[model samples]
Target: MAYETVIVEIDEGIATITLNRPEVLNALNSQVFIELGEAAEELSGDESVRVVIITGGDKVFAAGADIKQMASATAVDVSTNVRPSLRTFNFIENMHKPVIAAIAGYALGGGCELTLVADVRIAADNAQLGLPEIKLGILPGGGGTQRLPRLIGAAKAKELIYSGDFISAEEALRIGLVNKVVPADQLLIEAKKMAQKFAARGAVAIQMAKTCINEGLQMDLDRGLQYEHKCFSLLFATEDQKEGMKAFLEKRKPNFQGR
Candidate 1:
């Protein structure tokens, strides 16, 4: 599908989705959210794309939600707005393949929420991440409340929200908020490298692992372990597992087809 707010490009088992609204700091409007969902739907269905990297254009990853739109919106708009954005986020998190957020400049409010949805986040040295929605007289409408504490712990998350402070990429890495930090100019290159690494792995195993991790997190230990075991057992039935084992014994790299 053709996208206006975003650009989706696929190559070598990876899909790069760049938020293209640099003029507005790649702000999340309802239309942007809709386009994000449409792009994710297509990427999720394309077997050639084993991994996805979400980034922003120009100097900012995203300055957050479109402030003008949000300021003019009503309660109904607020309620309706979150649904599409969260749906888009969940689409990335719940996809069989991994999604990586390559953040630079600003990743505030809704944009920060978008970063949290990815399975992995890699930010540039200058990236500024925060949940500043409270400053706007509103809380984060996306998954901020739920995902932030989980990413950076309750105390730190609370500090950021209550104070509306932005942390640099270095601090984010120290707190385990982001997986890696790269030079400002190399953010996309580094993000693509991570995507390629994920693409080379056993796709089915990785997908099941992601499922187990996501679903099991909401359950008790015993139930979660059982789900993990089920996922492990299920993988034995896939052609990739057979090929993986054969490739192992043959002393050669496994070429996973994502079958």
Candidate 2:
């Protein structure tokens, strides 16, 4: 679907959603948030799309939220305006398929929160990420407070959020915030390469694995193991599971039909 603030492209089982507001350095606003949710929903329901990537051209992932849009708002107005974004972030985090973030330049505040929902993140060497909302007398309204700590540990999360300091891509990688960092020009290529690798896997197993990990994070270790075993046993009923094991024994590539 065509979008004013973003671009969606699907090719060879991969869907790429590009944040397209170069004039404002892809600063996310309410409209951008709504479009992102719509695009994510559309892609999630598409059977042909095996993996998804969210990017902001080569220059910048996103600067932050469009602060000017909220600078004049009252407390009640600000509360109401952020509801859609919160819902959208939740949807992306729980989506059935894997979601990858391809980040380049500035990714701050809401932009950084957006990346936290992605299953994997690949950043360019030029990337600068942070949660600087505290400087503006606000906190991350997206899922940053929750997911960031889960990803990089509570102490590191607190340090970054409290200081409002930007971290280099390499620093982000060291903290486990991003999975990989490549040269600026190779950002998209690396992201697609990783996506292609994931796309080649059995869709059913991948979905189950993602669900197990995401849901397990909220449960005790024993309960999480029980949940994982249930999902593991359930995959045996799928055709992909049978084909994958058979092909493994035969030393051949398995053709997964996503069944």
Candidate 3:
């Protein structure tokens, strides 16, 4: 689909969502959120798309929210205005297919929150990620507060958010915020490689695993285990499961049709 602020390209089974607007460092705005949500929704229903990658081109992921747009907002306006971004983030987080963040340059404030929604994050060596809303006399209105702590750790998340300090891509990897970091030129290549790996897997199983992990996080250990048991048992009814076992015994790769 064509979008004014973002571009969605599907090649093979991998869908790439590029955050356009390099002129402003790809700042997050209301229009961007709406387009992103629409694109994500469209991709979520596409059976051909097995995995997705969200990037801000090669130069920058995004600097932050459009500060100028929010400079004069009142409390009521601010409260109601953040719904689009929050809704978009939630859609991305709940999408069945895996989503990867291919981050380069700065992914600050809203941009960092954006990456938190992805299943995996691969950063360029020159990337800088942070929640710098504190510097703007605001806090991360997008899922940053909840997701960041769950991802890295409360202490580390708090340090970065409170101080508004941008961490290098290496530091982000060390803290487990990012899965891998490569040279700037290789960021998209690595991200697409990871996406391709996911594309090759059993689609139903991958979706189930993502559900178990994401939903299980909100449950206690006992409940989470039960939920996983149910998901595992349910998978036995799929055609892919039979093919997978048969292929294993025959020493051949199982051809999954995403059934």
TM-scores, all models, native as reference: 0.97, 0.99, 0.99
Task: Candidate 2: list runs displaced more than 4 Å.
Answer: none
Minimal lDDT window, size 10, model 3: 132-141
Per-residue lDDT of 130 in model 3: 94
lDDT of 2: 0.95
Per-residue accuracy of model 1 over 1-259 as CA lDDT, tens digit each: 8889999999988999999998889998989999998998999998888999999953799989998887787888778777888888888889888999999999999999999999999999999999998888888778888888887899988888888899999999999899999999998999989898888899899999999999998899999999999989999899899989999999999877777
lDDT tens digits by residue: candidate 2, 177-255: 9999999999999999999999999999999999999999999999999999999999999999999999999999999
Report the Cα lDDT for residue 257, model 3.
88
Model 3: what TM-score?
A: 0.99
Candidate with the larger lDDT of 1 and 2: 2
Measured by lDDT, the strongest candidate is 2
TM-score of 2: 0.99
lDDT of each: 0.90, 0.95, 0.95
